[model samples]
Target: MKKVIMGNHAVSYGVRASEAKVISAYPITPQTHIVELLSEMCANGEIDAKFIKVESEHSAMAACVGASAAGSRAFTATSSQGLLLMHEMLHWAVGARLPIVLANVNRAVGPPWSIWTDQNDSLSQRDVGWLQIYCESNQEVQDTIPQAFKIAEQLQMPVMIVMDAFFLSHTFEIVDIIEKEQVREFLPPYEPEIKIDTADQHSFGNLAGPDHYMELRYMIQEAMDRGLDVIKKVNKEFEEIFGRGYGLIEPYRCDDAETILVTSGTVSSTTRAVIDELRDEGVKVGSLKIRVFRPFPTEEVFEVLSKAKKVAVIDRNISFGAHGIFYQEIKSALYGRTDIPILGYIAGLGGRDVTPKVIREIADKAIGDEQPERYINWIGVKI
Candidate 1:
């Protein structure tokens, strides 16, 4: 059915469609609606699942890890400081190879304390061994949740579906929620190929000797490496069933363009409008909405971006003493290739509005010939 739903509600619908057997979470602003809706569903018997209420985000994820280890499909949602609290268990969930799905409402990490949007929280945990999918729209948020579960379980890794804190999370949009029966047909039940069984009584998470430890880590790497193809396969099946196709990285108007803007999350929507306006004016500008951030998708990014005359990276998060977090990654990906110049535009932090006009200005600057000065250029800021 089609309805105007908030991103959080869309996520809850996806979780229901995915048929999560165990949902555990603590309430955090911008992300609270997700857990609240799930709780109500569980209370109303809309979903046949156990909604575990924990004290903190840390315990929420810890309990989820335990539930997942016990061979149940577990899930959680958090934002900002809440995500920071889940830091330790994030490693545990991945190290134990638990197929847990987490919906991360992206918010700026605080020192002065703010509750707006930024990608710093999730990007900070880039090495935590979870398959990270940055969402562009509420529809993607709803669609990717089920796919995240399938991909995570298939690879024995956790997955984090990231959406902007307020932009997509709280904003209402018309989304065609996938049907329950169809999702059930597409994503099978979660039965881990390798699991801890009471019948077997084997010790899990035992300290491996040097001989076995390195190999175990190597095995995890292999699983992540293979997840690229696995993600593609799952997306293909999802598209076939729902007639909505997606990729690890979605390219917008990249074909025959001399320059491309690389971004993720809700900002991609703004860039799309900017690109269309530029196209109508006979200016060749395009965009690449990076969905999968962890495995980095270096090959696909290179193939799509390397040939362009210039590439502008607009990031919501900045790494201290470096360029925009994603901009740096793009630079590293395109290193040693002198074909395309890389420009960094850091914008939309702490819930600042990144309008189409701002994106157009950035695109105009990117397509121009200027000596690259600062690695990080602040956009939408008063000089």
Candidate 2:
């Protein structure tokens, strides 16, 4: 079934389809709608689940950790400051090997205080051990939600589904919403190996001594490494059932592209439009949308950019003094490969427009062999 929906609503549908047994979250801008819908569903008996409206994001994640530990499928969501508040429990969620799913609506961090879009919020938690999936459209948000559960539970690791603030979060689009029966056939109920309970009154998240700590960390790495395959398998199943397939990185017209654009989140949509517009003008350019950011698909990126004559990376977040966050990663991914010229362009902070014109301008620069002087060059900004 297809319906016109907001990104947050699409996410809510995904949650319902996943049959999440527990949902705990705080009310934060852009992120509040997701929980609101879930709350309505829970109250209306549309979903058989527990909706815990915690006072703070920290408690929200804590509740999810508790629910997941109790062998229930749990989910939660938060934005910039909210995610920052839950920083500590992030380690607890992954370290305890709980398969929790969180929706992080990306927002700009504040010194001057801004609630609009930026990647810094979620990217700031890149080291927190959660598998992060950056979404480009409401459709991807809907699709990735169920897929995230499978990935998280299979790996026994928590995952973050990152959608840009205001863009994917608040934007409306017609999405091919999956059927409930189809979703049921695809993602069955979650049953864990061990859960927090009275019969098995075993301690969870207990402090591991030097004797067993190293092995636990190693197991996490092993699970994450194996997650790549599991994710693909789940996506294949999703495509078979839903008729749509997604990947860690989605390549657009890269087969014979001379200049390539690398992007994530909603900007990829604008880049796609630019690619089509440029193609009609006889320009050999393409685009790549990177959906999965955490398990940073390095080898796959190299495989895509290997043939391009030049590459341009557009990012919505900065790494302070370094470079555009995704740009730095893409450059590192292609390091030592002398085939293509790569340029990094930073754009659209505070929810500014990353329009097709801006994308075409970037393509023009790369096409003309112009290089960015700095790693964090702003686009669509007045000089």
Clashing pairs in 1: none
lDDT of 1 by residue, 1-383 (tens): 89999999999999999999999999998899999999998999888899999999999999999889989999999999999999999999988999999999999988868889999999999888888999978898999999999999899999999999879999999999886688998899998755678776767899889889888888889999998999999999999999987798989999988899999988898899889999999998899999999878988999899768889999899888887999988988888866577899988888888888888878888887486545567887777
**Error at 109, model 2, angstroms:** 1.4
In Å, residue 264's CA in model 1 sits off its true spot by 0.6
RMSD of each: 1.3, 1.6
Over 1-383, each residue of candidate 2 has an lDDT whose tens digit, in order, gives 78999999989989988889999989999888999999999999988999988999999999999999999999998999999999999988989999999999999988768889999999989888899999988898988889999989989999999998888888899998865577888887888878887887888767889999999989988887887788889999999988888899999999999889999998898889889988999999899999888788888999999989888998888888888888888988988976477788888887778889888887887678555544456677788
**In model 2, how large is the Cα lDDT of residue 53?**
85
Whole-model lDDT, model 1: 0.90
Error of 1 at 329 (Å): 1.4
Candidate 1 ranges with C-alpha deviation above 4 Å: none
